[model samples]
Target chain A: MSYHLNHLKELESESIFIMREVAAQFERPVLMFSGGKDSILMVHLARKAFYPANIPFPLLHVDTGHNFPETIEYRDKLVEETGARLIVGSVQEAIDSGAIVEEKGYNASRNYLQTHVLLEELEKGKFDAALGGARRDEEKARAKERFFSHRDEFGQWDPKNQRPELWNLFNGKKNYGEHFRIFPISNWTELDVWMYLAMEGVELPSLYFAHERPVFAREGTLLADCEYIHKRPEEEAAVETRMVRCRTIGDMTCTGVWESEAKTIEDIIKEVSIARKTERGGRTDDKRSETAMEDRKKQGYF
Target chain B: MDNYDNMELLRFTTAGSVDDGKSTLIGRLLYDSKSIFEDQYDAVRESSERRGEEGVNLALLTDGLKAEREQGITIDVAYRYFSTPKRKFIIADTPGHIQYTRNMVTGASTANVALILIDARRGVLEQTRRHAFIASLLQIPHLVVCINKMDLVDYSEETYEKIKQDFEEFSYKLNVNDVHFIPISALKGDNVVTKSENTPWYDGSTLLYYLENVHIGSDHNFIDCRFPVQYVVRPNSDDYHDYRGYAGRIAGGIFKKGDDVMLLPSGFTSKIKKIDTFDGEVDEAYPPMSVTLLLEDDLDLSRGDMIVRENNQPEVEQDLEIMVCWFADRPLQPRGKYAVLHTTKEVRCIVKEIRYKLDINTLHRNEEDKTIGMNDIARVVIRTTKPLYYDAYRKNRITGSVIFVDEGTNETVGAGMII
Candidate 1:
């Protein structure tokens, strides 16, 4: 048991080291908080990185507007508790500002629109480093992402061209306009996230566990109740109270939920343990053939 | 009773040249281990159909780049994760192309194991040995020489034995301690996930089994405590204002709360008052744990400084002997100096000497030749502007490893393992 705890401790240390490198190497580094489990774990890890000191960097959220209310509430509360600054880059603002055109007709999620706002915010804030909680195992394109990903002034990521990160020493020098995207928790999988949560006793939003909610089925997945999202003509759902929880949350227009009775953290661990599907499987946006995440990532999507 | 259930995380990297079936081996491991999902399999099948391949091209699962998909080779490090109900593994899938050698160095830096895939038809080729040499220079604890495509070689134990012997004879000069060879056909699923009937003479466990069983808990250095302060934690709060914790991940050994430790670069002594995590507090800390250590005495310490146990201290020096894996496209400058990074410390260092270059194909050391080109593995000496606290790479991979950066270009040119 001691050794087991030691191994977990090792993982935490490596992550913390990366977090510190971000702080030391970059200027105005900010953490991308999605209110998802991965991002939540990242926030938790960032706390350990600079304990006794408030997370030196602020937490940034590229709001898609279409979000589970629980995610927004959790984000505010976590930031408040940690005493870290919170910066919001709203996709709806981008749409309203006419910087990005909202999707038309059915399946019009602001997931893609978040890129414009996020890129603009980074430019305006002069953030030299942005920490994200993206895991490589989540998608094929993400699998090839660098831990300290370099982005051009235009906020474009060239998978072909990246600086090699050798050892614990990270190279963070860049042009005035260029910035780095750091993924301190890049090696973790969904299961590892759950286990760490259990071990750390980290808090989470209620949306993470099973609960009754209004929903509709689309693209072979359940969609949570939201105003902006238009209901498909053929879909029908009863207002039944069923145990359910979200594995991932993005645009209220596209994120889905799975039926489960995993109310407690222990129950959720067991449920996720036997769960065969990946967390991304709950997202309808990624299900759009292959390379959706890749295309968006290239364009600087959070 | 089950050791596998114990927590042990292994970070290994896999690098391969064109047509090395690196993706196949990865897919094979995931598929046979039941890590593959039904939807993922379906997507791969559909993509295979879209690509007009006769069967599922498991490589499609990882070569996510359009250029790589078109060229049928990996161009970047694709990190893959899996667990065998024993040790969880994080694999840095690096490309073996000459231009991608930098990626390989990045991948191998954090790895405890290096799984080198060798085409059975081509025994001990240039790329194969180059990978092995890099693994050795990086001081990877275990090397799994997976002689893949055994089906191409008729599953003959004689062929397996010959390749194994040739590899062993070549690796003798290298510093790799644990070397293993497993003949497996990643395509046919032979000895990758389950025991293979093709080679009954080979009674070894499956490749996955071997990876699962390899002793990696001891790979880390528990002999010396080295904590490189990454940041100074000063939470401006009434409950924790006096709590100026030296925050860093433990690079090696263990540090107890009451342990007397010396702060490096400043040579100040302090006692660890607490090791705090979000889960409240811990009694002690070890290598890789990112716990915040609070000291009873707030001595002069900052980022890039090291914390070590008083009785068990690492050697402090400016000049160090290192075995380096050259990753720059431009050949290493003979007299040029660059910035060297070890742990969180950065110092200026020059290539003091190039002893010899290893012939990757034959695994022979060519003392007469000295070319630190891309993917070149060589022994060299470096003189640093500042003294770094370090242990031998063989002794402590975390503290002994360093990376050189081209100050002008800001590109990481090489990775060195202290000898």
Candidate 2:
């Protein structure tokens, strides 16, 4: 073996390489961390990108304000750990500042609200590059994504008009005010990230594993019982301790959880290996329609 | 199943014609191996209802694009991820039609193996030869030819043996070493996940078993260490004002601290002092690692500068002989020059020679035909303005492969495997 459990090291080297390119090619680059496994992997990669040196760039979080407390706690601890600047583009703050208005009725999610806040953050920071943890295998639209995905000033992606990313030579060159959404892990699959985490011994939020929590059934999904999510009056709210964990974390309203008892990375790997459900299945935002992810992606929703 | 300690990824591309049972085979693998999620199965059932399909549409899980659903054709590459108990897999669900060979090449570039699907009723078709040749040209080491729809032929051992013999004789001209043939009915779920009881004549591991047990650990080029610097890590903060790290992914081989390395094109030598990530300084760095490397000797290195073993240097030349898969809707004109990108290095190139265009099927080289269209494979020489550090495609895939980008349209016109 070249190195014991070197998958993470290899993955880490690739991410660091991408991160360094972002800093050199763009005037201002922001790491769009959402406190998820992929983004967590992104942050961990950034640490290696500039080891013996702090993360040169700032971390940008487009907070929907409907996130789990544990994820936020994990995010804060990570930010504190690296000493990198944290820029929060808060949806709640945006609503308070009259920059964006919250939805009123049932089926409302701040997940969509994240777009406006994210665009505003890019405009405010004048960031030329924004790194995301988007993987191609996760979604169909993402499968058509480029490594240096170009975004218009309005933050729109015209899937039809994408540049050819040949070999490893990425074209990071862009006009001023035009930002790029770089996905270093664009080639990485969901299982690869989980395996890398296990190999690297990277810690994540407890919400990832199977745990007992208050949940309610909505549209054939197990949604965490939270106040921000609009629930119908007739819907029954029951607090049952069940083994469940989230495949993807989003605004508490939009993200769903599956009944799983995978507590460790090994257990999760086994569970993932056997899982036929797409990770986005638990994501309520994606369950809206067949092309929900595509529509959102086109509208600059990450 | 016991030893996964040296697990390495095996990405492969699948190419076949429509109704070749590509989707069915993949679905069978997923279903038998139980990779499908409960909700995914539920959605498949619901979609099947909407489509009025008699059985669950396994294609619904993989064919995620809407146009593909509406048109019943695959236009772009669809990537599917599945892991067995032993190895992880990234299956590039490329289109079978000739029009989408560009997508196939993109998928095949990183693949270690290629699964060529053929209908048992239509053995040794033109498209089958085309894909197999493409796989061989791309230097994919393993080839698993699945003779699907065996039930149509009544699972006759004679039919299987005849087809295998014919295929072997036809493919003898190509340099494919690790080749295996299997008979299965993808629709009936035979020999895909579990061993088929009907196939008493065939005594081989099931498709899933083969996929899981394949020896892929040695697929990577571990002899030559090459790292292309992507960005210079400079945390110009007061806490560490002097920290400078060269960040990049290792293109091939291994790297460790105190190892003497040289930067490419410039030939600047430096000793690797440390390899580290934000987590901490690591002991070593190797192929595919995304790490920041600190060098002891101060050197003028930037993005695109390759850090390689000072001793084992690759061929540095301006003229390149390559086998390329033409991928543009516009026909490749004679002597047309474009931007050639290999690894991180980019250089303007001139098409030196068109050479002979080979018919993918029949193994016939048509020297008379002067035109090279979409999905056509041909041998050609290219002259570059600057020197590139590369190896033969047979040696190192990462450092050997290059792509021709149309300068005006900025489209990747072709993917070339260096000779």
Candidate 3:
């Protein structure tokens, strides 16, 4: 009777409208899944968008071959439950095929190599549009992104030369070889995502909840003590069990955990409401430089 | 958490150059409202120190692109979000330059309010007129004129009055409906988040308070029922074999169950059987809510079709008079063929005639000059391949606007408002 939608419902409707637009506009579209909360939210919205019909497209996961065991398990279960087709783009295959070289150092990460594999897989699948869950509030560079972002044949983003998007009309037209990176949740913030997840009573990975894990202190951050991460002698000696949870999910070598006791969704919501740091503050991939995300985005890194 | 279900979303656009302290005002809003995280503040502080700035430069918080940071100017529209207990705000921060009119138009398309910043000492520059003119042309419901830099003018009542008078005199020719004025200093944080005592003569609320408490419930058109079908949902499974629903976001008016509706392009009349959403069925659906409508009788309907009230129907016309803002480098060729995207329909249109171009600064119509180039506003006539159901822009924004995409290049070239 109010005739007015709240902030969360408004955001949800906007995102659903965008996803339906993509389905109607593009010929061969795919959703990019990373087993993160944002991507999980995207899958849920997509399911609600076409209600009785199966999701009109498959989900593309660019696996870095170094992920938390729980993430892979969650991804498989979600795919099966949603009845969605899954397509994996493997970074390990690209590294073995000599398409990309893995970094060699104490802080080696396959995060940068995933872009190559993703582009190659897109080319293989002949997908014209790939939907992503990247939000504008995540990084400074992403703040300037449009809902329908165009990419050249080389899979590069030209930040300066973007189409002018007006109102709800989105122009998804492109050339033969070119494609677009569509973001349905470009307007939602980190806290909005958490609140929506909690409101819907959605299931998330156990990594998001606090649990005892072996972590080591590196650069004032608690990195999970795993074989994927190459640590120094002192770091190895400093490994200890701590109660921590992941604010975000990404490559195991790059994502850091926050020490916390918040276990339930309500506890996480309360924590996020009073948290003083941005969600990406714990992401090691973004700390390299001020324009690190911009540089990576230009090279077609989602 | 209790207020989460009742909070509203307000989107507004701000237009100003770097000197008007636009970035500083935004930073102050986020900081004072406890929206800016500590890490973001620390990053801005470090960047300021690296640039050898005297103090923490608030402008560094915005200007996201690498080139923008290096050149100290915003090239494109950047969106920023913040929320209070009562409302969540989205700021479409745009640059106020003569060449960036396209960017400003893009940002102003969806904004409920347009914030125009004017330097108190400068007193209504050309940029201010251009911004106000665009906001009015875009038909933004409300306008907030903030006379910035009150501290530089010593917070004098005379200065504020003079500037307010000047803006009012110029705004008389504009079509803006609701206008509010406030005096603030973005640098010293006076009358921005909290009211300032320096301006004891001023009786208006602060900028944040005005934004939070603005009346926007009546902004939507709720009298005419209009639903542009975007997609057709058909779940052909064993659980539900004979289900057909028209999915779309309501463009105008209110639609209730068992109401008589007519579909466009195929004039089939039917009664609404039910209104369905992901959560459950609703008794009625309103504007901006995406839902599926099930009719009592099965009718031939697809995308680009519209469901409207039987008594109130939009004008079906093949020829349209539109006021267009060109956004591409290539000049709009007379008698050119382009792709036109209306509510949920795509059709081909040819440029029939170029009536006249408007000078935004002087508010004069140039009938002699007919060349419409990038960042130019002109009146045009176009004929579509198929008739479109539309209303005047002033009547309903959602059902009356369109975009022209170049057929060859596939780029969005111009934005048009039905006249």
Q: Where does candidate 3 clash, by residue pair?
A: none
Listed per prediction, chain B TM-scores read 0.93, 0.95, 0.98
lDDT (C-alpha) at residue A129 in model 3: 96
lDDT of 3 by residue, A218-272 (tens): 8877899999999999999999999999999999999999999999988998899
Q: Score the docking of each candidate (DockQ).
A: 0.63, 0.44, 0.84
Task: State the lDDT of candidate 3 residue by residue for B178-283, as single tens digits.
Answer: 9999999988889889989999998889999999999989888999889999999999788769989899999999999999999898988999999988888999
RMSD of each: 2.5, 3.4, 1.1
lDDT for position B317 in model 1: 96
For candidate 1, give the docking quality class from DockQ: medium
Q: For residue A55, what is the lDDT in candidate 3?
A: 93
lDDT assessment of candidate 2: 0.79
lDDT of each: 0.81, 0.79, 0.91
Q: What is the interface RMSD of candidate 2, in Å?
A: 3.2
DockQ of 2: 0.44
* Candidate 1 vs 3: which has more lDDT: 3
Total backbone collisions, model 1: 6
Clashes of 2: 15
Candidate 3: list runs displaced more than 4 Å. none
